[model samples]
Target: MGPDLWNANYDELLEIPLPKQVQLTGFADDVAATIVADSAEETELLVWSTIDTVEDWLEQHRLKLAKQKTEMVVLTRQKRFPKPFKVDIGETTLTSTRALRYLGVMIDDKLSFREHLESACIRASKTVSSLSRFLTNTIGPRTKKRRVLLEVVHSILLYGAEIWADILKQKTYRRKMAAVQRRGALRVTCAYRTVSEAPVLVIAGAAPIDLLAFERAKLYNAKMNGDNSNEARARLKKETLCEWQNRWTSGEAGRWTERLIPDISVWLSRKHGETDFYLNQLLTGHDQFNAYLFKMSLHPTPTCKYCPDKIDDAEHTFFECDRWKDYRSSTEEIIGARLSPRAW
Candidate 1:
């Protein structure tokens, strides 16, 4: 084995890269050239960076070649080849909450598995986002707005669907998770503000909190090492309620934050009386109650020179003002006719 034999044999083949050369003809000639080359140095560096044995190179190269020759040929060129197969992100059946987390987004020159856990979470979150969008578009308008939160929650809960299908089927599983189930329900209920506390017309009719509230609560529960947890739950509860207030105040929902809160107050008045009050309230006078009252209030205007005062809270706008007598009269008439009936 010397350089002459190696050069004479491989000179024609080595002109092109191994991957490209491998396509025109098998790697047999390449292997032979590397074996009979001038020194082990050339063979090691240029030919066999993997190992010394011909058999080792052949075995590995065969698989690599098979992949290159397959559908991956075009993919390899596009840098999309050899995508590691994991759970499909676009598939609705995958439901893994663990995937909602991520370590780092950028990969270094030497890629390691430090980011594996986080990467999994990122992928899962992305999949949930995708599925959520799909479901939102498909489920129709009534429930479409909740697409983001529901998709994420379903993905997290049912992530191991194949494994958990039997567990989910058994009523025994729900019984074991009675604590979690209760907490989940509480998260949903508490994430919403009572009509009385914030009386906004939009929130009067038992408008549910966004699904993010429940998902965040569940995530919080998981972080607590399976001990029943309310830290995430509590944060989410306030976060969602606050979001409603924010949106309403910003005028996205066409109502004044303060004046509109009375409808919410009225709605909450019904719930303060019983356990599962949202349900119990309906059994009595809840259905007849008008949550729509708050939404109909005038949009808050900052430059109301006619408001007679600084134009602050609902009390200032409605009760103590003589400046806007005409506006007040109109309001009185509407209230007397519309809301007074509901109150009595």
Candidate 2:
């Protein structure tokens, strides 16, 4: 049947008065009824009576309730469990479940939403792994790969973020979501897996995943309050970037990267260039630089191989080394300014 027909059916269902203490809500053909009472027996009695009223209504409309697709769940926060009960409508018995998938979000007995977040992470991880098989650090189009990660994979992970985004405030949940983003960042930057999360994210020009989720939640709230969508999004983008910059600056990791990219906003605002393998290496300081290799225990010393006196890191290679002077001068001439650690 069409949506208008279903809407009319639901509108008619709303006119049928349910038992006392019971409330009924229908969306399309799915009906959810709730009863709040002091005891299980009273709740069950009210539920049965409510079901009888619903069944009678359905019979008049010649619609049979799908017994196999029906589910019931009891939500409680008590330390001791409530007594078990079966809800029988016609010949079907509905057993209470600890959790149920309503719409798309998973609702648990305790309403913690742990199950839904875990499932989202799993799904995002799988999508990243599958994409990784086809795309590589140097082989694929960097922009498209990043687009897929942000558009496809992120959509999967943040399906119902507006509702559950608050859970990401917990360190455990934040870390789980960050791990998935880390994988995508690795692909985007084409950097080594050894690169830490903050630097990889910066080099990849991706905001922190938790920050993105929080932005989504805030934007949703703003829209509900009658704010303009585009204006709200722009304002939230600035706020999110500020938070990301604060975290990056205050954190202990990615110190070298911080020097190269002091302002994340400038880095992200670049419209033309993509972060290719070489550029990612330069920004993250995770390339074959002697200093990084030495830190990784793959080289004997941190001295530059060409200069043999200065430490060879991203800063030295990009700004100090004489070997790349011509390339640096050419870039400086193109940009009409000299390159310095603080220039960006």
Q: Give a tens-digit lDDT track for model 2, residues 1-344.
A: 68997797668887787666777777667778877767667767887887778878888988876778877777765445463457776688877887788777788776788999898889889998988886787787766456666567778888888988998899999998899988987887788899999998888778888899999999999999999999999999999999999999999998988987888988777776777777878777887999989999999999997899899988999998999999999999999999997786
The models' CA-based lDDT, in order, is 0.35, 0.83
**Maximum-TM-score candidate:** 2
Tell how far residue 247 is off in model 1, in angstroms. Answer: 1.9
lDDT of 2 at 65: 68
The ten-residue window of minimal lDDT in model 1 covers 67-76
**Candidate 2 vs. truth: CA RMSD?**
2.4
Per-model tally of clashing residue pairs? 22, 0
- What is the model-wide C-alpha lDDT for candidate 2? 0.83
Q: List ranges where model 2 is wrong by over 4 Å.
A: 83-85, 333-336
